[model samples]
Target: MKFYKANNMKPTVAALFLLSLLGCIEACAISLNAQKKYPYVLLGNDYGILNENDLGGFSWGFKRHPFNPKDSGGNYWQCFPREAIEITLKDTGSSADDIAWNDNIADLKIVVWVNQHLVHEYGMRKRLSIIDFERRFNKWREIMKKEKYVCLAGDFVNYEHKNENGIDMDIYEWLFEKIKTKKSCDSYLYSCHPTYEAYLREKSKEASYKFRGISHG
Candidate 1:
């Protein structure tokens, strides 16, 4: 979750090719697997969701990934709203308890974060909200070393303000379209457990939980 950092995380494919020529098949394969396997985790404030990662390809709930702990590679990573991050609490989880799940709790929904900043939130009736995608794109494109997180609601749309219907077309563009387009910035959307431990520590204050309002203590 390094933010505003200048390090670049994009691994050059040409380098991968060179490794292949150098007989680094096993290592290269492992790296490629990391790139293809883990990216985002669908998690509420609950820990149970992550435990569901064992379900074959559906193994990204409440999960975490470590990207660069020792900076052996010394690079940056950015998440380009690649996809809408979706999370469901499974009826019971730490998040549910943390917020003191009572009928009066207003059904504190999910949150979206970029560079550890709150972007938007959703509720039971309006269980989803798309962020200002254009603003996000402009802010993140030059980041080159920041990770952005997008959250989604599997539930139907409902909002008290009556401003939400379900999927905001504008938000959809920010979340999906930008993903298809290469981010002008040098960023990488890694998994929950990132390999960069030191950076997380230094930037801990800047790293947003994305599950702030949940009662799942």
Candidate 2:
């Protein structure tokens, strides 16, 4: 009777072990899939998001008074190399909206820059702009070498508080309205403030265990 009971228990234990292994496999697969889908993970202070590329999609790089930053942000933009840009445009993966996701929150003008000099205004027109860009690119190449980054910069709206008679006023603009530029360029590289990153990691941990957080240790 004891032997019979042990035999039955063996099968039950084996079944449970197999189920657990399968569950682990599924979790691993999902993790890998997410990694592939989002090649670059931008870890924020309170949230983390995935992105296809890191060069020039949507950056919180430069900050200016809600009005003046737009011109500086819009004047200089960079993106992927010519081949990547061609592939992106061919696939119709690039969009003006991609340049600034918060356009609904504010108005902006941006330029797609191959470098400091070579540039084109990014527009979402129906026609393919790749060939036209190529012709001009080849012509420009005659003058200088090609670059490997796609960047955008122009007047992008930034919210700032102004002091008026000891009172603070919040300034903001809608996309339908134009943003004013600064007297000089004020663009900078994309960066994450340490305090902000720490905050994001803490928030992410509080939010979900599924997210990968920056290791302070």
Candidate 1 lDDT, 54-149, residue by residue in tens = 111223222433322222221112222422222222222223335444322222232333222123232232211122222343344443224343
lDDT of 1 at 84: 28
lDDT of 2 by residue, 74-133 (tens): 322222233322211232334445544322222122222222222234332123334443
TM-score of each: 0.19, 0.17
Candidate 2's TM-score reads 0.17
* Shift in Å, residue 116, candidate 1: 13
Candidate of highest TM-score: 1
Pairing residues by index, what is the TM-score of model 1? Answer: 0.19
